[model samples]
Target: MKRTPKTLLVLALVVVVGMAFRVSWNALRDVARAIGADHTAATLYPFVVDGLMALALVATLVLTADARRFALRVLGTYTGASLVLNYVHGLVPALHGASVDWGRLADWNPANWALVLLATSLPVGSIYFGSDLVAKVLHHQPTPAANAEKTVESVSNRSMADQGEPTPEPRVVNAVPIPRPVQVGFLKPTLPLKPMPAIEPVPARPASTVAADSVRTRRATGRVPDVARSTRPKRTPGELLQEARAASADWPDAHLTADRIRKTVHTSAEKARGLRDALIAERAA
Candidate 1:
């Protein structure tokens, strides 16, 4: 694939995001360890914080309206929490496994207690906020069964309206109607129909006389006469070919196509083709 400007920009974005996430992950992991999380807990702690942030970010993009606002709130909360933890890790070098005084925070100062509370509560908050965000997203999305039921209800309502029937109350359960055998009864006529008069049989005539009569009847009715019954004498193939040759003798070779020959000779397409080929061959000779 050709590398367009958009593709290049997206690649650059992905690279930057991956690098940023790696840096954040390391800082958050260190912060988790500093907050008294054990080895396994510290390792998984970053995922809880950073993973919730990532989920919120995706939800922000995928969701819209009120849902999107909720996702944005979740994303901002996690982002701020991660930043505070990372900042604390940087400020207190003692948290980075350095030989330093824990005696400063040991005095049970309210500010120090608040800081400790904030660090411990972040993981719990991540869990609560993440669950709520996921639930909100799921709630916005309509399930297939719900959609099917709505469709069924709408169709049933429309059909009832068209038939001029009173609309029924909506059913709580799936109301797909069962197929039942319909009994169709035929009604007998209340009064007998008038007896049809007997139709007289048409006397057959001789073929030649019948053809002449049909030709005359067509002419009287202003309809085109049938070819078989017309007064004009039918010409043989040889006669038609002779007439075509004479008629197109002075015409250009371009005008001597089968369609033109057929119109000029008033003959069948097959006969016209044969006549046109014969004329062309004669000219060549």
Candidate 2:
């Protein structure tokens, strides 16, 4: 594995903690022995104090939220206890190697009683705190059900990729074609038909007279007269309806609105509305 900065830092911390623990171990064992513990109890006393502190520190780093707070409390308690014990061992020179007069400090002496109580209670406290700390750590770990779900999802994705299956595309509906307005012209009658009056024919005019008249007319008006154009015949309502139906034959039922139909068939709004209603009713039927 690559030796990252974090790895190197952890290694350095481990070395520092190991050396510190070794030094404290001797001091704590001596304190236990000085407090009237047997040889076997003195041998294991250091582990109860220093070992629990290490476990609490590890739990503090591993846990989160409330569990981390609990681990921190455990770590602080053990650390303080270790500090007090080590300090007492240093202060009382007899705890190092010399034989001490235990009978001189009677049960009535508060200092002697307190020291004995702290030394004796450590093992029981370690058992309780250590078990609770471990339970908290285990409780915070991912559940088997969650792990199984994640594993299943990953396996499914991997299998799909290995099979070279393409992701399905979304369905697209076809768009309706909108029709443009068609311009139609119609001629209106202004007057009733009348019989033509009989007239006598005049002699043919000479080319000169015709040319002179055309010149004079142009001079008077400054332009030639425009010829009249014929008007287109009007379409009946039936024809208009037929045209509207043909234009909207492919249109969707929802698109058959009055405005759209009016624009498409070049008809009046009222007529378009009627056609729209009729088309919709026919489709529904």
Candidate 3:
């Protein structure tokens, strides 16, 4: 056992032993006086000591919850005997005195003092243990008012819980796979330079000479030939560049590829690349 409980148990035992000793000592002294053997000046009647013991025994029985029936019967018999003795002792003195000497009969000896203390034990024990017993009985028997209040409280709690907002379930989303970015080279050219073809100086022909040659050729052929009619229109380098610039004005320098320029400007890939370079140069300037 723990120290505190152990100490309390020991103290309780000491108190019970002390009360037993007090009761015994008083009873013994009363017995001695009745047999004409006691030397003390104390003059209390023998019945007084027994009466106090009886009261103590009754108190013990009342305080004990689980006392056996046989034990209770024995205590009851003893208490009845003590009460009868007390009445008989009191009457015998009164009969002899004609007028009872109450003071001398009930004198305060040490044993009587102890007996008085033992007698008072009943009320003290009854107050403490009797209240506990009553409280236990009350606890076992439930009240309707208390039960109704509990029912109301439980219903209100359930309602409040139901009315409370529901927590949202957490969303589980698949993580998007990020595309791996293309790594660019720092030294790569944004616009490629195209190789320009060598230009030969042509001797200028007079307008009259050009007109005479055209007329003579037409006369010789009767009309323009199918070969001449099927030939594509030849655009100047300046015209090709202007068309490429207009088509790719919104395109970044790096995005202006030869194929993109050819599609937009309707030109050869080489000429388109040259035009794209020219457009990039113009933008840089």
Candidate 4:
């Protein structure tokens, strides 16, 4: 059960205590009246007076904090017994024409004022204590508001304790949104393509110039320089004959004729003939 502040509980306790005092005082007065010589006591008077006293004492004991359950039982018995006894006593005396003197009641004193206060508070105190006792007996639970307050208090405590420690960073959940596909139709290009430009031909270099370039390239590349082409319209027979003879060394002796020399040397017939004759003379020598 959620604990409440002691204020209401204390108030209820005070009321019950006041009621108990009132009841005890009433019981003691009844016993004294029955015992005093001024009042002639009947045979059952002592027992009735003492019984009320006993009940009042028990009520006082039950009204205490630890004995709430018994309070209800004792209070019920006392109320029932007291109601019957007081009613009978008042009625019998009234029927005998012994009604209370109102003039005597008007004669006020400190004790009378006190009694009046006690009488007024008795029912109020009884009601408060009775309700509280019933709730306790029935195991009345705390309301949601009370529970909520308790929960808040507990949470605040936890937060205070956690304040001294490092707070963990909130977890970052990587929710990658899916890309929506675009729905587009294929469209033809509107721009026209231009025609390709025609390639122009370059003029050929002279044979002499080409030869010179080749000679220079050969020299630079560490290669034997080739024989330079003659500017003379007529070719050298000796030079052709020497080249043909050197080239024909790889051929059989029977293949070394004037026609083969002409084809191999790519020269005139006279030169080829002279070349072939030179080769034969060289073989004979």
Candidate 5:
């Protein structure tokens, strides 16, 4: 369906046909020898044609994983070389002792010259371009190695991940969910901005012991799990009190004491403001 697959299929067919012809030619040459006719010239033709086709087929397969730009270069090199060589020197050799007919070759124009050059040296060109493309693709660093390394390092990470040793579990915890303090119109206070910390998937084992389960690959809908983002820090007493005040604003009896305030306020912002006010008011008045 795709261009590469189609091209490969075509090349595969050509390789098979070319090889069949070569083998058939060998058998024909043996028959000619039995009859005592000069068959050496005919015998070599199939081998050359088949060898050239085989080179082209190999080049096409190599292009499958190569970059488009580079693959095109290699693909071009193979087709160009194979077609030329197979027609001229490869097929022409069958008539070795016969007079070289320049007029018959002229009917095909430059195709004759192309065949000669390709038979002699086009495959080396294919190898050069194909090798260059493959080398570049395999060495591409943008593709993350973490995914591949996951299989190798998974065993190593298992022990440290267990025993509550600060293992990276898929759960994100104790993260400040506030915007970073950025300069806007004025120096406005922002919720403490903490980065979305990296989370490791919690191994599906009991919290106490991690069973080395076989690595399983899963298909995901590409949503980050909430467990990977569910961390809230412990708020201070004053911070707690402010939250109570905000929630219980209408209740006049909301006291600033830890126990009373703890029951009253919630959220980081409310508690921080309430405690800051309470501490400063006592010092001033």
Candidate 6:
């Protein structure tokens, strides 16, 4: 069955703990034997709990890149699996051994069942999780906006007419007199068409234009007129500044505060007042 991370973790815990309990049971069995406690059955109970515990623990986690962790996991899995297998062999000695159990045999141990399940299951869990992880990692992204735009442009531009005009229907004209099927064979066909005019390539012009182009290219003109220099100087600087500022502020966020932009009349008045003040100061000096 397909196992998820949650299932694996739970199963691993169950297997590990169950295997540990089995190990304790094996010890108890040995002690019971020492005390002469009867464990008489169809076969001997297997005592391989250490191996099963290790296997369960290893299978629990082996996906990480850490080699040390991986090694430990591998060791644990091997030992645990061996314990589970050995326990099965011990419990059902008749299966491995030549003789059959004289009495009825228990199908399997509950603790052993848990160990076997976890020891083998971790790999399946890892594979399922790893496949999804790899797929997500290697997933391809969609075409970018620029690439999609280019494709759209190319697709939109393609035209059948651009390639060539459509083929016209073939015209078959029989002599107007032929109205019968058998008599049509003798009629001469007349195809109406305009004779195409023969084309002649154009002769090149005299080299004077080329010379004019070269002169245009070689001779640098005087400094072009500076658009910033105002011919109408009488129009004060404030008026020009606003116009210049408006033209210059062409970009998206271009703005100006209302209070700072006064009309040229106010600036001119201020300049006149300054001149008067300067004249008064000069007289006092």
List the global CA lDDT of all models.
0.79, 0.82, 0.57, 0.56, 0.51, 0.48
Please state every model's RMSD to the true fold in angstroms.
15.3, 28.7, 33.3, 35.8, 26.6, 18.6
lDDT of 6 by residue, 42-80 (tens): 113223334333443443343244433544555555455
Off by over 4 Å in 1: 1-4, 98-108, 142-285
List, residue by residue over 1-285, the lDDT tens digit for candidate 5.
899999999899879977777655554343223223345644554344344444445544543444544555555655454444333434555333444453232237586454344444433554565466557656555545667798668766767546355646697679778987766667665777568989989757663453333344556878898889758777777555456546545544334344454444434455546664664465458
TM-score of model number 4: 0.22
Could you give candidate 3's per-residue lDDT for residues 149-227 as a string of tens digits? 9988877778656758768999999999999987766568678868999999999999999899888844354788787
Question: Between which residue pairs do clashes occur in model 2?
Answer: none
Candidate 6 ranges beyond 4 A from true positions = 1-47, 63-191, 204-259, 262-285
Which stretches of model 5 miss by more than 4 angstroms?
A: 1-72, 84-99, 102-104, 108-163, 167-285
- Candidate 5 matches the true fold with a TM-score of 0.28
lDDT of 4 by residue, 1-285 (tens): 335657778689879967765654444334224223134443234334334434445444434445544664546654564454444334334322324342111135664354334333344455565455555545644347878998888777786566577778999999999999865446555777578999999999999998898888443565555556555566576677667868998888899889888888788787778788888888889
Q: TM-score: which is higher, 5 or 6?
A: 5
Which is better, 1 or 3, measured by TM-score? Answer: 1
TM-score of each: 0.45, 0.48, 0.20, 0.22, 0.28, 0.24
Q: Flag the better candidate by TM-score, 2 or 6.
A: 2
Number of the predicted model whose TM-score against the real structure is largest: 2
Expressed as tens digits, the lDDT of each residue in 110-133 for candidate 2 is: 877777777778889999999999
Off by over 4 Å in 4: 1-114, 136-139, 142-173, 186-285
230 in model 2: Cα distance from truth in Å? 19
Relative to the true structure, candidate 6 reaches a TM of: 0.24
Instruction: Name the weakest run of 10 consecutive residues (lDDT summed) in model 2.
Output: 98-107
Write down the lDDT that model 2 would get: 0.82
